[model samples]
Target: MKYLVGVLLALIVFNASAQEEGGLKRPDIPGELMVDVGFNVWTSMPGGLERRTWSSKSIGIYYTKRKAFSSKLSFNYGIGLGLEKMSLGDSSTLASAVLDDNGTTSTDDDFVQSVLIVANPESFSKNKLATTYLDIPVEFRFHPLGTEDGEGLFIGAGGIVGLRLNAHTKWKYDNNGETVREKTSGKFNLNSFRYGYQIRAGFRGVHFFYKRYVSDVFKDPFPSGESPVMTTVGINVTGF
Candidate 1:
């Protein structure tokens, strides 16, 4: 008898909660999850290096919610995680600054440098750096066709800020007669935080995204004429 009474009470409570949730008209609905795939690279460094692989890629996934301020204007905000793989032509590896503490004031105190990796090019076929980050994305969306019926074309512009999570380098090639691959991980004094402005345009569930980071990639005292900023162009897949 006691068990039967408990079951009845539980059913009553559950039914009431479900009715309140499904019967009410909600003003805001969740936007689709977003995925971005693209190519990435840095600018403002010294010459003689190049990117040779489409394998230098980037990817991100986000969960966002959209709230309407009007029939045509809405805002979306979300959190995401992303990875970037940047490949540099053989012979280059990041290095600490070469400092000369002479009394002469001509030497600039800023700017660490990248030194060459002396391995034979025949044996060293590839080298790339990879980094991961936790990202926060905010955008204001404008839909001219209105969202009353569902999704439509949207133009959004906003900012994305990232906090560094991990960084590493991978190398592959032949050493002797055997194929070999190596990985090394360290901070490399990389910047712990970064933020940039971005813009997107899409119809329904697909969008194109472009972003340029305003901060340096490294935390070192970099001298003038060096711009180690990162930039990417990609497509965002949403609605799933």
Candidate 2:
């Protein structure tokens, strides 16, 4: 994660330096620096798994090149880094479930082959799963009445493809009158790739966006149509 952040910072610095050196013309080829803050809601979650809406959130940072087709239309594409956290509720946590030798479900075995949401053995003040992704976003945008220095009323439709970078669970609790924090990192059967549709509209530097992923959050061992689907609705801040 640190490496990825460092790389992104380097790219930003390089871009700024190039602009300062007059290597790029801002008005001729516009770009956007955007930040997304959103709430995550899951649909079709398996029984026993629930998420807290307020605590489940996502943040993203992106830089995109805007290629204008005309005064009122453009195509944009970018790369971004996303941080997502899901806070599980109902005193529940995710665990690895096992299957028997015959490839049938069994709770008593030691083979960790699938994911299961189970009650935590002890109460936790914080219990959450977090993931990181490298994302590619592409969109078509329309600016009505035209844009003035990248600020105006506009609407866009886009799609994003994300490649999973990491996944883990974290817990914070009190044990023996002392605070205890535990973190475990694993694949956890999470989908390695996800694609989604995005719709955004707003004026000036603030925008509203809604995103929904058609793919499942988990892979095999989870039956078709039984896994969680992710959706996000939130605000976007752009142009610095």
Candidate 3:
């Protein structure tokens, strides 16, 4: 969190200085490069699927093009890469149910289709799940003062869609005083696509953003109602 705050402050200061020096003139380029850093949380998480709030983080990088509808309103669209890490709490790890030769199962009793099993904390030093995605985002922005020079108060509402690129679980444990790090990669019944809504508001190039995904994180065997919904809130820094 401290690192995020420092970056926000630096971006704000740099943007303010640039505006002062350039005197409100719009940049030659109409596109902006944005970086997002945030904390991830799960809503309606199933029992035993607890997350370590501060350790679960998200990062995204995007290049967006803006089209002005008016001095105070504009449309923007972008493509980006997003990375997320979810560190489980209470020394828990994600596990997938085994399917028989017929690829069918009769195990719907679990609260979460993707099961989370608790292990002794002292037995493991690290445990986490990570995912990567290719993302596209669209937004309609309202800049109260004007869109030129990217100054003053601006508010935007947008939707984002992401295609899963990779997902995996990692663990580190001690084996007779020898540390062993293991990583397992699999589909894990995770959804191939995810969609979410976001709202952003701020001054100049630094903004606060809140995003929530309404779709379930898993598919098929994983019950939709029992799947986790992801939420992120954080700082966005934009540069031209």
Candidate 4:
């Protein structure tokens, strides 16, 4: 009898949440759970060393609920795991500079510099770290055209907040026509936090997404005393 009562209480909470303003949705076929995977290309730098941008991909699953007051407006949120892999651009200028990684002098000729003007790796290719994060997204979706009876286009705008989990760096070089790998301390801010905002448009289950970063990859933009801005372009696989 106690077990039965507990089950009943759980059902009541679940049902009430599904119907309330902030809650999950009723299990149905038409709902969308998005999975996003794409690459980010860094455009310009604070200093001006052009390094090859690598691939950064993320996967997230969102549960959506359309409001009864207006089917055109809805709310969605979910969790995900993300990874960022960065490679520095090989340059004589960058290779020649001396870098201070947390007060350690590294003359390895490949130390990417996170600081500037004072003597650190070039701004573009310093600190090649692959960082991991746990992400949570909250979005408000607007459907303008399609009513309940037909298909229409919708737009979603919102932000994502993430917590950093791990970070590392990989050093790759050619050895007698063969590849060699060395691991270095991937010392970087990794932001302790990662996040961005996105604008999306789509019809039905497919949507196009443009996400922009609002937070800096590092706490200090420059060791030299300057600010840096980085951005990327991507598409949402599960769409809007």
Prediction-by-prediction clash tally: 3, 0, 0, 3
- TM-score for every candidate vs. truth? 0.73, 0.80, 0.76, 0.62
lDDT of 1 by residue, 1-240 (tens): 232245348545645655554484322434556778888878754344456558788887777777779878888888877678888677655433333455232333343333323234453477777888888888888888888633788898899999998888777777677777877776756888989988889874778999888887876534434548888889987765
* Pick by lDDT: 1 or 2, better one: 2
CA displacement after TM-score superposition, residue 154 of candidate 4 (Å): 0.9
Instruction: Flag the better candidate by TM-score, 1 or 4.
Output: 1
What lDDT score belongs to each candidate, Candidate 1 first? 0.70, 0.78, 0.76, 0.54
Better of 2 and 4 by lDDT: 2
lDDT tens string, model 3, 1-240?
333356458656756665745375434565777888898887765545667778899988777887888889888799877788888764567665544468565376543245445464455667788888888988889998786755679999999999999888888887777888878886666888999999999974899999899887777433334667888889988774
State model 3's lDDT: 0.76
TM-score for predicted model 1 compared with the true structure: 0.73
Off by over 4 Å in 2: 1-30, 97-110, 221-225
The segments of candidate 1 whose C-alpha lies over 4 angstroms from its true place after superposition are: 1-31, 46-48, 95-123, 221-225
Which candidate's lDDT is highest? 2
Ranking by TM-score: 2, 3, 1, 4
Clashes of 4: 3
Q: Clash number for model 3? A: 0
Candidate 3 — which residues are off by over 4 angstroms?
A: 1-30, 96-122, 220-225
